[model samples]
Target chain A: MTELTRIIELFQLPFMQRALLGGILTGLMGGMLGSFTILRQLSFFSDALGHSALLGISIGLLIGINPSVVLLPFAVCFALGVTYLLERTRLWTDALLNIIYSSSLAIAVIVLSFVGQYKGGLNNLLFGDILAVRELDLVFSGLLLIACTVFIGLTLRTQMLLTLHEPLAIARGVSVSAQRTAFIVLLSLVVGISIKAIGVLLVSAFVVIPACAARLLSRTFTNYVVLSAGLGALSAVAGMLISAAFNLPSGPSIVATQLVIFLTTMALPQLRALGHG
Target chain B: MREIVLSVEQLTVYRETYAAVQDVSFSLESGIDTAIVGPNGAGKSTLVQAILGILPRQSGDVFILGQPLSCRGSLAPAIRQQIAYLPQNFLFDRRIPMTVEELVGLGWDKLGFQLPWKDHRKRRHAIREALVRVDAAHLMHKMISGLSGGETKRVLLAYCLVRPRRLLILDEAPAGLDVRGESEFYQLLYQLKREQGWAILQISHDLDMVRRHCDRVICLNRTLLCQGTPEVALSSDNLSAAYGSEFVRYRHRH
Candidate 1:
């Protein structure tokens, strides 16, 4: 009946705990990798992978396999395929990405027609259900967080070298092509795993939003990465709590919180400039 | 024997079945600034790229530090690290989120190895030194995308110089610079070349600058036309030979 009692009741539920933990982990991972996603303009690629996960799911259902398990490798392959196309073809980039993700979604729909539709099985993945978060899902997200953090830490300098100037990086003896492949695989894994919690529609927002927000405030590279991850975690926890309080869906709630953060952080500097003037 | 930093022998590269570069060969001696001068589409950059093992050589071989370039396997990185390069028309994303300091740090820590506290500090010190040498110390905190054309060139030069190098390959390293910035870039390059005894190999269209600065010049028009001292290479006769009727002395700035 009371607000405090209602809040206590929410925390008392095990599923709520799992959702909170999973959301926080996924958010942090997304934020960390999102820095590179934004810088490398791989947001579109991540989005495509997100959609491609649905195609994987459709194929899994058709073959009587678990969709969640199939999503990872399928997404990785899909990203690699895109990378290969980019390297080999002179097609305009916008047309290239548009063709890839759209074809993926279209294939998914056709497969869904034969294997049955989004009634129950597909609905869960499309928009996500935070209330259905399980202990294993939490563990998977936690592992992804650790994996992303370690990869970013280890490859930070090398990836930056490759990204800043590939020819120069090559001259400096960096295997930029190899490094690029590794980065794409990691991005695919993140996008694949993220689909269960944030869904295809909102997965990229978790990535791009926190990084865009952090970009406004960070003055250095290390600070930018740290801040993005921190913002992501905060947005996750805060958004989860807000969603619980208001009985709203968790994914969009979290994205709204991040958008607000980006706007506020972006405006603060201009506001300070106004004060100075 | 005089120290040979790089030797390219009969290198040919094809782009879409047409020879972008054909039977190009030249050797760079240590402490000498060598310029490869040519007209547009002459494949000067292509030659430099092939030498660094960035592009496949259709034929012939490149020996850097007296070892042949394999362009693959474990040896490539080590060999590449020995040669510092600045690419002409470096494909830069204008919205790339990085500062001059961080980007330069990328060049300093090329292998992406996380160092201990002392080594990390030393790396930072080396980065600062490179920036200072290139006269870009003041622009260290600026966002890379926000820099002016000349400043970007200086920062890129600093980035290339962050690590130890035996051979320095520059592809139009001074493209966007003004008169003063261009001269300053050359001065900084020559000062370091003299101090470190580096083999300076560069691609340029500026015959006047090449004549003033380079010890040796290789004139190219899709292939080696002449390789000699700049006086001999950039003479009216030699320029006409490489550039054909397109070559005009008045076109070159003093």
Candidate 2:
């Protein structure tokens, strides 16, 4: 079979099909929420949440529960704690996120050392094994996607206003605190679900890269959001196909694909300018 | 008779441990334009933030249209919604792709948890009317990120005008504009105040503008130093007390 046909054949397998579905769902969720994350300058916060997932996974391994299940609540609480500190303590955002990111990572490493036969399991989570994605994982991703979609769809305008100018949004009575907390909660959930398909190391790339690409190409906010979702899904599928074709690691391949898209977007304006010149 | 629209009583706000504004009290009535004047660090912005409940006040009571908007450290949202505020700086990420029309639409009076089922035509008309009122109708379709400083101010003013407000508070709304631009902006604001009977409260540094357009002035230097008609409040003695030796040089320069 030709290379393209061979890649298609790989995707025809049931396990590959599951992996593709999980990736697409994760991509959609990440892309939609990532726009807000990027706009609110919460990219570092999202990265910290992703890194902190390792602690959740390590704890689950210690307790003999599925890491994925444990990660959901762990991430939610982590995000809420960070949000509370940010609101109450008034520390600079980067300072707090950096402290959380580094500390969580250190604790996770120490915990992982205690986990017997941890090498294989840790590698799978850090780099991801899309072929190992189970049906239950896909279901969780689907439900989370729906929850995010409904919440974002219902509050798009108000969320947009808040993202653009928070003080004005507050003055206009947009329930800024409640909406922000809801957003952070949804983001943590997305990070938890996404860590399975994208891996802890590359998950933020999955979340932020497509949105950055979309911003480079979009002319309006609505266009930016829709394009972000589109680019995310497109990158995930393309990355999976590349992974299958090259027999490469799925998570890093997906992130690499997203970077390629971002670079292409960054270069488009220049290319157009060159053409005009 | 014009009713009192905003009342701030014994308002005290602190930054860290020091009182930034102390025992400041003022009331604004409909059809009267009021200005707050003070030197730098006199708690002009802090007073506004405290009254708007953006900042936690040490002790204060802020009422709008007879309803308590804030008491001590707590703010009532329903009461605060009645007042429109134009902050000194309209801060946002420049890369955001919002349009002037979209920005103004965010100020629509009916913004709530319900789906936006309001009449689209009426909403569009209101947005257009607000932009036109600010001489920014031509900018409705333009991206907010691409707007110039003056255009941004006009668009923000249009945002405040999109909804009915019991009181309008502007925090140095004309700070960066040229002398002509400042005069014209104040003129437009005065016209809006006259037409809508808006209780206008603004923070300003231009003594000339305060003397010309404001019905009353409140001078501050950590505490209320003066509050009266511009003639009394902007008197040399009161100016000296609020601004210290700096005002004498500033007054002589003008």
Candidate 3:
């Protein structure tokens, strides 16, 4: 078969199509939420949430249930828990984040150890076997993407800006607490769905690297979101191509592509003046 | 007498076990410019935060335009829509990608009723008008992270002005501005007060500007020390009570 035909054949399989759809949806949500994440200096928090999802997913597998369903509530609970700890506790936020990040990973490893591995078991969530993604995963991710987009687009002007400067937002009559809670829930949802494509270990890279690259190129916050989404989509496509050609793992290849984009943007002099390097 | 726009009755704010502000009572008339002056750590910011519903109130009631301020429910947003606040510290991450125009446009985001004029052009026009009012129109397209301290303060003030809120509360709004910038800012404040009939409550350390610009002053040192015209409130006893003997002497020297 020719290259195009082979590529078509790869996607013609139900699993490959599911993986592609999942990646695209995750990219859109990541790009949308990632702008606020980077602006609020919560990149570490995103990573923490991603790792926390692993523990949730592993626990789901241990109970013989669908991992995604189990993982959503677990991730949201963890996200709210972290938010409360950061707001109420005396500990510095970064220190608290690091503790949660490592502990979640450790818990996942312990849980996975108890659940004896079958062939391509945890690897599906780690490296992401694009050839094995189910149709249900595709449908769920699409719905999530649409919901996130509508909510974000509706409150884009007020709520997103609130994360940038909360006190100001409060002063202007924006529901500071409500906006924050909604944002955290949305972030949790994004983290929960993204684990299937980028995996728990590398999901943060997908959210952060594209936004960081776009930050260097854009002048306004609106432009930054658009550029980040564009970059993220571009990286997903490129990574898929590279993975197909070299038979590399899809998740790592995607992350590697994003890093390359980040580095290139960092080196550009025009972007350096914008202080994104 | 004009109607009271803001009334604080037995207002108290506590930080953990310690009482930061205690039984502070004041009634600010509509269209009046009131200055809040006190030494650092005297709880000026705490009082402001309490009034804005950001801090938990230990006791007492805050009424804005005859409505009791509720910390929860839609009342908070309703009260907030009528008031604009400028925080003591205005810090943004240098990595954030936003321009002056976008920042100012955020002021209209809280108009939650979905007015017919939600179009981008209308929003842009409102932002541009606000910037021009503060003499920051030229910097509309400038990146926020690149602006100087004085410029940033101006932009923030512009942000506050974009919405036609009845009460404008500013905490050290001109703290870091140079003499000219400070003078120009207060001039703009005077214009806003006279032309738009805005009621302004500001916390300021600059005694001269307080004396020259504000109609009344409220001195605080954990409790209400004095409230009246600048000369009356800045009396030696009140100054000493709020700022200690060192500030009293410093004021006399100047």
Identify the candidate with maximal lDDT. 2
* Model 3, span B43-159: residue lDDT tens: 999999888877878898888888887754134566677788888878767777889988888876664534323687978888999999888999999999899988887788788
Compared with the true structure, what per-residue lDDT tens digits does model 1 show for residues B196-222? 778889998777788888899999999
What value does DockQ give for candidate 3?
0.56
- Which residues of candidate 2, in runs, are more than 4 Å off? A1-5, A88-91, B70-81, B109-111, B116-118, B249-254
Worst lDDT run of 10 residues, candidate 2 chain A, spans A167-176
| Per-model TM against the reference | 0.93, 0.93, 0.93
Error of 3 at B158 (Å): 2.1
Off by over 4 Å in 1: A117-121, A274-277, B72-76, B112-118, B245-254
Rank the models by lDDT, top first.
Answer: 2, 1, 3
Model 2 lDDT, full chain set:
0.84
Q: Write model 2 residue lDDT over B50-88, tens digit each, in one string.
A: 777777778878877787754433445566556788888
lDDT of 2 at A62: 82
After best superposition, candidate 3 residue B40: deviation in angstroms?
1.6
Q: How is the predicted docking of candidate 2 categorized under the CAPRI scheme?
A: acceptable
Model 3: colliding residue pairs: none
Question: Using DockQ as the measure, which candidate wins?
Answer: 3
Query: Per DockQ, what order, best first?
Result: 3, 1, 2
lDDT of 3 by residue, A1-277 (tens): 5877777787777766666666777777787788778777788888888877888888888898878689789988998899888889899878999999899889888998988884447767765555555777777777887887777777777754676777776655567767778888888888877787677878888779999999988998878887888888788878877777677888888889889989998888875677864
